[model samples]
Target: MSIQKIISTKSNLVTELLQNIAIEEDWAKIEQFTIALIDNFKDPRILPGLVEKINTLPFDEANAFLVYACGEYSLEDCKVFFDLWIELVAMGDFHTASNAGFILANLPEPFDFNERQLDQAENKLMLALSKPVTEEKALVIKEVLELLK
Candidate 1:
């Protein structure tokens, strides 16, 4: 299956579908799509196209699953995604924030983050930390902060 098929050609509507899937907590579908992306990730065209689609998404909520799936790439392939995750985390949706945090924390080694990116991520993380979230997500955010330090 092609990446376009696995993800969706209708960039504007994919967010609604993803939001429903996230709200339903459909692990199988999410994993199925992610695995498909992983299978196709080595293809020369996948990441950039996927990143472009993600960049065009309307809101951070739309990015949660895609970001989580993309987290498996090597740092070399991951650089393109890291900035988007910073933006997602800055939006402070707990699902996206924690998933972004998890990805950031698990990078092969720390990246030299951009100053503005670092500032936004730190501010949002600290804000999200002060709010109520699942204990698990809270832990992930805390670990991400430590990783950033």
Candidate 2:
């Protein structure tokens, strides 16, 4: 199938678990993928390089799907995972950040910090909302806060 078709399908498949966890079927393999992704985040490796290419994919859903396929990440690898989450947040892309937050929230123990731990995250979103609200960004913030709750 073409890349566009794949992305369309992936977007359909992507859903927020518990309205919190962003998951796809491949979530079963997340731990393994997380290990590798973490390693790649810290030190470049062959697989990570390929994963980077996958992440940069123009199709937004495609990139997010790749993250799901990797499975549950080990929390020990959380620093890198958290970094990715922050980066996604900083991107100021609501859909992307929402997806990233759901994934980060579901990350198994060691990685999953308390809601309080994300004081900064909450603050950031709050500040973003402090400005004139665009309907789209407003909705995104709503979705994000609900997940955080």
Candidate 3:
């Protein structure tokens, strides 16, 4: 179903719809929903639940979209997204890892990282870069490395 139909319905089913779309690997619908969620993040009623649902998704294209959507959140509010991103990076989902890295690179607020945490992130990125990845992923990895520097 179209995101417009889901939004117009305004049913509590938005989360369910998102879950189904993600499970079904419907990238188009997920992108549409991500845009809608990002646009409406200021709405108190929608943000929390949406973020929570996004967090529940396994690392995949949907989670990549979730990371992009979570980019609109404050650093504090984005901790969960960061955690998921790091995990995904370690597990080697190149698209999600690269997108998450981009989000971290551009976060509006500074995220304080301990030396060990910084080292770990650096190691993960370095390792990922060593492996074969698409040019797009490599570009994002380089951008993230620049930010880390």
Candidate 4:
């Protein structure tokens, strides 16, 4: 169903779990394929769901869905996941961590950090750097490290 129709029907699909801990299926239903085309598609209803469960959801699905969220989110909303991004960067598996690192870099402008966050980011990036990665991902991680400076 189209997002509007799904929303209009109160389908218990997107909205019910949108601001809470959604199951994987719940996130999968969001109109991710077309979300960007809508532009200005900032559905504030998503605020808590994205924050509360992003790291735990399946990465490929969550990552794709989150790209749209990041595109529309205000810097403050983005901050709620700020520490989660840093933690994701430290994961040992590239499959699990790369997209999180990608999102971390692409999150709203400034992605401003307090002193403790900066310290934590530095530590996590250092751990990430110690693992094997393609040059492309390394560059992405490096860019985030630069932002911390």
Error of 3 at 30 (Å): 4.3
Q: Give lDDT tens digits, candidate 2, residues 34-88.
A: 4444443332232343245444455354455444433233333434556455445
Model 3: residues with Cα > 4 Å off, grouped in runs: 1-34, 41-59, 73-76, 89-95
Model 2: worst 10 consecutive residues (lDDT sum): 15-24
At residue 89, what lDDT does model 1 achieve? 63
Candidate 2 TM-score, true structure as reference: 0.40
> Alpha carbon lDDT of residue 97, candidate 4?
54
Which residue pairs overlap in candidate 4's backbone? none
Write candidate 3's Cα lDDT for 57-124 as tens digits: 77666566666566664445655455455555544356776667766766556676678876777788
Clash count (model 2, backbone only):
5
TM-score of each: 0.57, 0.40, 0.59, 0.61
The alpha-carbon lDDT assigned to residue 103 of candidate 1 equals 68
Off by over 4 Å in 1: 1-34, 53-63, 90-95
Report the C-alpha lDDT of model 1 over 1-149, residue by residue, as the tens digit. Answer: 88886656544344444444344435567556545555543543445545565665655565676666666644456665776766566554667777777767666654767888777777877887787767766777777778667
* Per-residue error (Å), model 4, residue 132: 1.1
Model 3 residue 13 CA deviation (Å) reads: 8.8
What is residue 95's positional error in candidate 3, in angstroms? 4.3
Residue 78 lDDT (model 2): 36
Among these predictions, the greatest TM-score belongs to 4
Mark the regions of model 4 whose C-alpha exceeds 4 Å error after superposition: 1-14, 17-21, 24-28, 32-45, 58-62, 92-112
What is the per-residue lDDT of model 4 for residues 20-93, given as tens digits with 9 covering 90 to 100? 33454554454442243224344555555565555555444345455445435554566667777666556424
Q: TM-score rank, highest first?
A: 4, 3, 1, 2
